[model samples]
Target: MAFTESSLLLPSVSGTNKNKNKVPEDKWYLAYIVYFTLGLGYLLPWNAFITAVDYFSFLYPDASVDRIFAVVYMIVGLVGISLIILYSHKSDAYVRINVGLALFVVSLLVVPLLDAFYIKGRVGFYSGFYVTAGAVGLSGVADALVQGSIVGSAGELPDRYMQAVIAGTAASGVLVSALRIFTKAVYPQDASGLQKSANLYFSVSIVIVFLCMVFYNMVHKLPVMKYYKELKVEAVTANEDNGPLTGPVWRSTVWNIVRRIRWYGFGIVLIYVVTLAIFPGYITEDVHSQILKDWYPILLIAGYNVFDLVGKCLTAVYLLQNAKVAIGGCIARLLFFPLFLGCLHGPKFFRTEIPVTILTCLLGLTNGYLTSALMILIPKIVMLQHAETAGIVSVLFLVFGLAAGSVIAWFWVI
Candidate 1:
């Protein structure tokens, strides 16, 4: 089939191809923006929650709630994705995304409400934490639904759209990082101040989510986008001999995808393992600087977020064509373990801010670039009928890596 079922369903991207199938030149940018917006909406929730590590720790001081929250969020997302795979084929992509995003914004709004209603001190800290964790899980469900559907939807679209989605995910990191920097700088450095700051951050997220939902629904209505949807449906249905799979065929189709992209899956797992094992939680808790003091963790995280954006964006300029090279680079990320360890308990200079900052940037850059590359490659290599499954597989690997890395992160302080 000329258009994979995967791409056919995603918010259509603007293609420069002059072919009859491509959207016209004027509509191209609008379509691309819509697709990019979908990517932004899918990931911003996780970024907003995770980036607030310092605030979470401040609120739930006694328990290791941050680590627990991090791992649980990923695990819940893993579970959500599993559920999505079972019934996702039965649903429409447009409906799935709007509903998911609506739920996502609601989850973020709940954060401030927890702070408003609950006692701020130790008396009700655990209660507050529980509410917050529940909210995080809600966000996870939203993430899984929106992310899997959009990527799966993009299956029939151009590779650039996938790249745009990945890049948008990285952009979320950047957005959260900036929000953290702003709120922290503005708010007073006291308990009440931190609470207010965190609330303000979530408020911004609510606005973004609303805009995203509006834009997403609007994009699908565009003449060009609607035309492609009808075109793909006609094309794929005309070849019903190998049409959408049923229960027996569905199971076999997913299994075949696993076999085909097992290596890509491994690389995805390792990349997140290396990343999740040490990111905002460890970075917020473990690293310190006598010089930067409180500013140390904040700046380091921001640096990582910015560079991660840079890495994801770099692929648009030049993606390494070889999967081996990309996979090999991911394996090498294991080195960050020892390198970080050395910073914790090595030569005095290693413990300093300069070395740690440099390493953090490298970590973000490599992680961003390699992850985007793998996501882009896996779908193209798989069969058209299973492209969405392949996208889901990639997400499955991501959450597994996140869960594994979160486990490893716990051991750091133990």
Candidate 2:
């Protein structure tokens, strides 16, 4: 069914004028802020687990804590997202997001509860490591349920909401980095200090996840949200009347949507492949500085996170709006490979803290802007009825990138 601009502008209802129910206002931008908060909240659990890597490493001395976390989380998330894409038509976004939010609370609670009651600042507890990894996997599953739904839901709305969601993801990183820095400054560097910092991360994440649950439920009650959702329902109903969306028909429709957005998907995959190959793994494990000592990685991570937030927010002011240029920019990000490699094997100056830090910030900046561009562009390319599926499909491609990038991180970094 061809969904034209006029159809979306004036969806058929029982008895309403074409221009009677114009799109409702967001009213102080509450819906945008809620979406922003939802985006931030979903990633916070993953960040909490990753940001407390030092403590986890200290506890599980035998394991490659960072690499293992990345692999397990990304793989699990990839699988979960694939399943979400397959069964999206059978379910709904509202239920999926609520369930995912609850799961986030459960997964986040695991670490601190275990530490407080059982682990108790002890060492040589491989079992604890395994349990923690399981928690990470749970968070990954939660992320799949929540991230795709949030992005897909936003896809059905105006472009600004999508920008808010993408920017919120970057903000999550900045928030975690700030928490890491605060904990480092306040707590002593001993075991007690590490445990305290780790606990703080989980506690803060739990609070935010709960807030997201509240705000998310509150948002649907808003008039602006009702307006968009009503239009979506009308569009879907119109499409269904043409014929029942049988399995094969739906699959073919999904494939068509994929074909249209394949270039965007490729760019997203390449972006993460280059980024994950060099980041956190390289910054945290490979590099070292005599002056900054333990603080070097933290500073580098903070710089990257701050710049990422800047890049994501920039789209709000001036979106590129051109897919060709955005994809080319993603291709250009590959240069980071050589630049970062130089930090390891190039001249003395390239190996210094300054060059490495700048490259890392650039990596984040590019990652943020390019990802937001592709995501915002995907839904616009598809019909209204398929926009949600398109959003989920895009996220599935993104998870593939994350999974591949995580695996490569182990081998790509020196």
Candidate 3:
């Protein structure tokens, strides 16, 4: 059997091979604008968490603020997945995309407000959890919307949109990390004080996103709604071919795909969870201890972001274009088993902080390539059928990854 299920399902092999080249050159610019604007909104509050904790710890000395934030993030992710399934099934592409963008911008704006007012002066671990979780939970609404738009437009747009997303994430991570470093250097006291200054910074980010939303609405001349209409048509066509099935039958089919794909997605997710688990310990114990207090997190984050950016960019431009599903699957499987062993043995050999940090960075760099590869493979695995099911599978894999990391952390500590 051929590696790909069918050539007809493979999105255009080359940019020039697209069916309807209706995407205007101007639309490409709009896409970049969307990328940069939303990128800033997503990252600013995220990076701000580091600074916020510095301030919040002053009031609540015993709380593990980062852990609190992480737990809340997990919950928000679950809710977000639910929203994606519901909205993607019912809503048109344009409404879903626009509403998603709006919600995301609103979430960014709400973060500062929550911290500055409601959680201000509170002195407990859960305070950070509540504020961060509430902000991220709201943001999940936006994420679902964006993903719905992506699935709806999958075959319609160039691969550049996916590229832009990865690039934007990398850029945001780097830029926000740099900004935290700069703010610490110049306004050292303010960075650690009431967080009023950081609140101001996030407020500026919200404004930029709002402006971008307005611009996107104005310049989006293509019939974005029509994309979802077409998706519905495709679904109907598939149903007709397969013959009408009961709800239970459809459920069974989706579950079968989920089970088959779990190992593939889980492999990638495990790598990430291990990296995330190792990172905080290494940064706090090794990196911060060795380096200047202010420079440690910034440098590590900057390096991680740079490597991730390079990996994703290279994959998008080269690997994904020539991707064969079998090759992609083999690489994922090969890398995953070693990576898992590395995570298991790493703490034993690289017992020191510095060595562990290096290991973490390598893990990050390798995982970046794997992540980009996985995203590309996802569409091919499911083809156009049951895309929403595929998306749900991806999210569940990530959640499991987090859980696995958390469990490993407990064992390592013991």
Most accurate candidate by lDDT: 2
lDDT of candidate model 3 versus the reference = 0.55
Q: For candidate 1, what is the TM-score?
A: 0.88
The global C-alpha lDDT for each of the candidates, from Candidate 1 onward, is 0.77, 0.88, 0.55
Worst 10 residues of 2 by lDDT: 1-10
For 1-414, candidate 1 gives per-residue lDDT tens digits of 133424534333334222445453425577667777778767777777766655787877776766676767788888988877777667777787888899898899878776666654333367788878888889888888888888876655556777888888888777877877788788886777777777766877788778888888787777765655655565445546685666877777677888998998999999998898888667888888888888898899889988988988887787676888889999999999899989898999998898999999999999999998888888878645456778887888988988888788777662
Residue 185's lDDT in candidate 1: 80
Question: Candidate 1, residue 352: CA error in Å?
Answer: 2.5
Model 3 bad stretches (over 4 Å)? 1-47, 91-97, 114-133, 140-158, 190-194, 215-220, 223-246, 288-294, 320-360
Q: Write the per-residue lDDT of candidate 2 for residues 159-230, one digit (tens) a residue.
A: 789889999999999999999899989999889999999999999999999999999999999998898887
Q: Which candidate model has the greater TM-score, 1 or 3?
A: 1
Candidate 2 runs further than 4 Å off: 1-17
Report lDDT (Cα) of residue 12, candidate 3: 29
For model 2, name the residue pairs that clash.
none
TM-score of 2: 0.94
Backbone-clash count (model 3): 0
Best by TM-score: 2
